[model samples]
Target chain A: MTKVTFIEHNGTVRNVEVDDGLSLMEAAVNNLVPGIDGDCGGACACATCHVHIDAAWLDKLPPMEAMENSMLEFAGGRNESSRLGCQIKLSPALDGIVVRTPLGQH
Target chain B: MSRCPSASTLEAAPIVSETVIIVGAGQAAGQAVASLRQEGFDGRIVLVGAEPVLPYQRPPLSKAFLAGTLPLERLFLKPPAFYEQARVDTLLGVAVTELDATRRQVRLDDGRELAFDHLLLATGGRARRLDCPGADHPRLHYLRTVADVDGIRAALRPGARLVLIGGGYVGLEIAAVAAKLGLAVTVLEAAPTVLARVTCPAVARFFESVHRQAGVTIRCATTVTGIEGDASLARVVTGDGERIDADLVIAGIGLLPNVKLAQAAGLVCDNGIVVDEECRTSAPGIFSAGDCTQHPNAIYDSRLRLESVHNAIEQGKTAAAAMCGKARPYRQVPWFWSDQYDLKLQTAGLNRGYDQVVMRGSTDSRSFAAFYLRDGRLLAVDAVNRPVEFMVAKALIANRTVIAPERLADELIVAKDLAG
Candidate 1:
C-alpha cells in the first residue's frame, strides 16, 4: 500500500494507505475526500476536484495543457501550485507529496 | 490560434511533494483529486469540505434524485471504496473560515489550522431565495442539495398542491416530476415564456407546449405575492390576485454564487468570481472554478459564467494545472443539457449576442436544433432531442465553422464533416 498524507485547506492532516496506479482524484473520491469532486468522471469537463501542489515539489510535477488552463478560468482561487488533482496519476514515485485544498469544493 | 493539446500528453513526471489540499466536496473538487492521481501526482491529498456527506453530483438533485428513481449511491461518481483505494484524506463537515496567504495556512471553524503550499476553492452556488412574506415557510423548497431533494420528494405526495415559482430548468424539471407523480404542478413565471431568458422565441414555444401538455399549468407573466401557508403548510398567492392551492412552493428562479469567501479574501468578483483566461484571480495564488466564476470566452468575446456541469468540471481541471505551475488557459466551447419529460435539450456555445436562429429539425415534431448565428457566423445551437445535431454543433462551435442557413433550414446539412 502507498501511504499518502492529506493536509486539508483547514490544515487538517489525514494519512491513508492506497494501492498504486490509482489517480489522486480517485484517491480522494474513494476516501470520500471533501474538496475533490471529480464531477465529469475523469473527463476534463468539470473542475470540482481541484487541489494545490506543495511548492517544494513544483519542479517534479507535469505541466498543464491548454484545455486544463482554459478550464482553470472557471476555477476560483487558483495559485502557482494549483493543479487539478484528477490530472495527476498516482504512482510509487509520488509518495509523500502534499496538496492543499480551498475552503470548499464543488 | 493553435488548438490546445489533450491533457493526457501534457502529463509530466510528477515530483514528490508533501501536501495537497482541496477545499469543498463538489464535482470539480472530486475530479481534481482524481486528475492529480491519474496524472501521476502521488502527493499527500487532503479534501476539506463543509458538507456532512461524501461528494455527490447535484445535477440529479432537482430531477432523478428528487423523483426517487436513482438511489443516492448512483449519485456518486464512483463507489465508496474509490477514495479509500486512492488514499485521499477526506475531512467532511468542517468549514474553513479564514485563509492566510502570507503564512500559507487556513483556519477552521473549530480553531484548527491546516498549512498548505497551494489551495483550491470549489465551493459552488446556492439557490436564490425570495424575500416575500412567508418565504421561510416549511412548504417552501429550493433544490440544491440531497437534503433539499428529500424534503421536496416528501412534500410531493400524490394530489399535493405544487406551486413552482420559477420557470427555469430546475423549476420546470421539478414540475415534470411532480405532475407525473399525480400532483397538480403550476409554474408561475414573471417572464412572457417559460424559457424566455435562455432560448429563442421559437425554441421557447416548443417547450411551452411540452409542459402545458404534461398537465402542468404554466402561468406566464406571473409573480408570487406571498405564501399563505400555516406555520407548516398552505397556498400561494400571485401578484395578480390569483390564488393557487399550493401545498408546497419550489423556487427555481436561479442561483447565487457562494462568493463570500472569495470576496472576503479580496478576489475580484462581479456577478461571479472573475478569473482570467488562465483561471487566475486578480490576486495571484487564488483560483476559482465552477458556476462561481465569470470569465471571457473567445467565442462570445464576452465575460460569462456558465452554470453547467461542463463548465464546472473543465474549469476545475484548468485551475489544478495553473496551481501546478503548468499554465494552460481555459477556452472550451460552452455546452449544457437539460432533461424535461422525454425531451433532451442540449446546447453548445452562447446565443446571447446572436441575431439569426435557424431550425434544423421539425418543430412540429417537438424536436429540433435551433442554430444561433451572429452576423452569419455560427455562434451556438440549442438542440432538442437531436444528439447528432448537438455533436455536430459542438464541433462547429469549437471550430467556429459556418453553415449555409438554407441547408440548416432544409435539414440537408451533413454532420460528419463537422466532427473529427
Candidate 2:
C-alpha cells in the first residue's frame, strides 16, 4: 500500500494507505475523507472528484487525458494544480503524494 | 406554522435525541447518511436494507462489473468501516414489512419493530421482468443487484449465445461487454428503435450502428412471445413465430419502483411515491428519495421519477437537510450517462417537449452533441464522446440559458463560450 495525504479545505488532514492500481479518488473515498465525492464511481464522467495537487508533487503525476481536461474545464475553481482524482491512479513511484480538495464539489 | 431552521438554528440546537430511520440501503440511502452527519444532525441513524450487502453503486453492475474489469469491493458506496465510523446502525438482509405513520414505527421482516422521528424511504426500484411462458426459467436473468449480475456473468461464456430483451442502456451495455468477451449477443426492442424513450432517432441510430458494428444483432419493433426450453437448451420465441436459441436470456425492459410499502401506508403514490419539493411525503415526518419517488422538478416544472445516480445523491442530500429542519427545495437539473464500446453518452436535462434539435460537430467522426430546444430555450443536450459539451450543457440547462441554433451548432466557437 502507498501512503496518500488528503487536505480538506478546512485544513483537516487525512493520511490513507491505498493499494496500487486504485485511483486517488478511491483512496480518499475508501478512507472516508470528506470533500472529494467520487459520485461517478471513478468513471471520470462527473467532475465532483476535483482536487488540487500539491504543487511540489504535481509534476510527478501523469499528464491529464483529453476527457479529464474537458471535464475539468467546467469544474469549480479550475487552476493549474487542478486534476480529477479519478484520473490519477496511484502507483509505487507516487508514494506519499499530497493533494487538497475544493471547498465544495458541484 | 413551522419556521424553516437555518444553519445557525441547527448548530445552536442539534436534535441529538431524535432518531432517523432510512429504508432501502442504496446510493440515496448511503448519501443521506453522509449528508445527515455533515449537516450536523447528530440524531440516532438506523439504515435498514433488503439487500444482504452494504450500499453499493448500480451503474458499474451493467458495464465494468459485468465485464470483469471492476471488482465487487469497488462497487460499495463506502468502505465497511464508514457506517461504523459515522455511527450508523445498519440492518442488512431485512425488509421493512410495515410502516405505521401514526405511531412513527416500522416493522422489519425479521419481526422487529423500530420507532423513528423521521423516516426516509429510498427503496429504489426493481428490474421489470418479462412476463411470458418460461419467464421463470433459471437461465433467464435481470441486472438490478450484484446477485443478478453474478448470475449473468456466470452464463457469459466465450461462445455462449446471449439473448438480451429490451434495447435500453442496460441491455446495450451488457451487449457491449458480452460481445467484447467473445459471446454472440442479440438485442430485442419492442419500440421502433433503441433508446426511443430517452433520445431522438438520430442519436438512437448512432448507437444502433455502433452496436451493429460490434457484431451484435439488434432487432427493433420485435416482441417476445415466450421462452421455450428444457434443461440443457433454451429458446426465445418471438411474436413472428421465429424461435431463436439462446444459452441465456437477460431482460432490461425497465424499472418498477418499490412503492408498495409507501402505498400500503397511504402515502399518495402515483407512478412513484409522491413527494413535495422538500421530499416530504403526504404523511408528515416521512420523506422519500431516489428512483422510488415522483418528486417535482423545478427546472422542467413537472414531476419526475428518475432512475439515475445524480438524482439519488442530490435527493438524498435534500431529504437529509429537510429532516434537520433546514428545509431546502430539491431542484437540481437531472443528468444521466451510459457507456458502451469506448463511447460515453452523457445527457443533461429532460428532452421532453423538444421542438428542434441542433447538432454540433459531425456524427461521421463519431464525436458530437445534440442540443434539444423548446421555443428557443435549451431543454436538454445529448453529448456523445463530447465531454466538454456535456459539462457546459449541464450548467446552461440549469441556468436555463438560451442561444441561437447556429451558434450552438458552430464548432469554431468553444463550448464554454457558448454558455455566455
Best by DockQ: 2
What local lDDT does model 1 show for residue B134? 79
How high a TM-score does candidate 1 get? Answer: 0.78
Cα lDDT tens digits for candidate 2, B1-420? 153356677789876888999999999999999889888888799999999999999999999999898889889988888899899999999999999998999999989999998999999999998899999887888999998987777789999999999999999999999999999999999999999999999999999999999999999999999999886778999988989999989999999999999999989999999999989999988999999999999888899999999999989989999998876789888999999998988999999999999999977788999999999999999999899899889888888887799999998999988887
Q: What tens-digit string does per-residue lDDT give for candidate 1 at B1-420?
A: 122223444465463564667778887787677666755556687888898777788877776778887678757766667778788888989998987656667788899998875577777888899888878788888888887887777678899888899998888888888888999888999999888878998988788788889898888899888888585666788998877777888889898987787787777899888888867667656667788888888767789888888787778777777665556688888887777887778777888888899987788886788999987778888887666667567667777876778766765546434443
Report the C-alpha lDDT of model 2 over A1-106, residue by residue, as the tens digit.
8999899999999888988999999998777688888889989898889999999999998898889999999888999999999999899988999999899888
**Model 2 residue B78 lDDT score:** 83
CA displacement after TM-score superposition, residue B240 of candidate 1 (Å): 0.9
**Predicted candidate 1 versus true structure: per-residue lDDT over A1-106, tens digit per residue:** 6666778888888776666766677677667566777655444445667788888866777798754554554467877877777777767788877777777653
Each model's lDDT: 0.76, 0.91
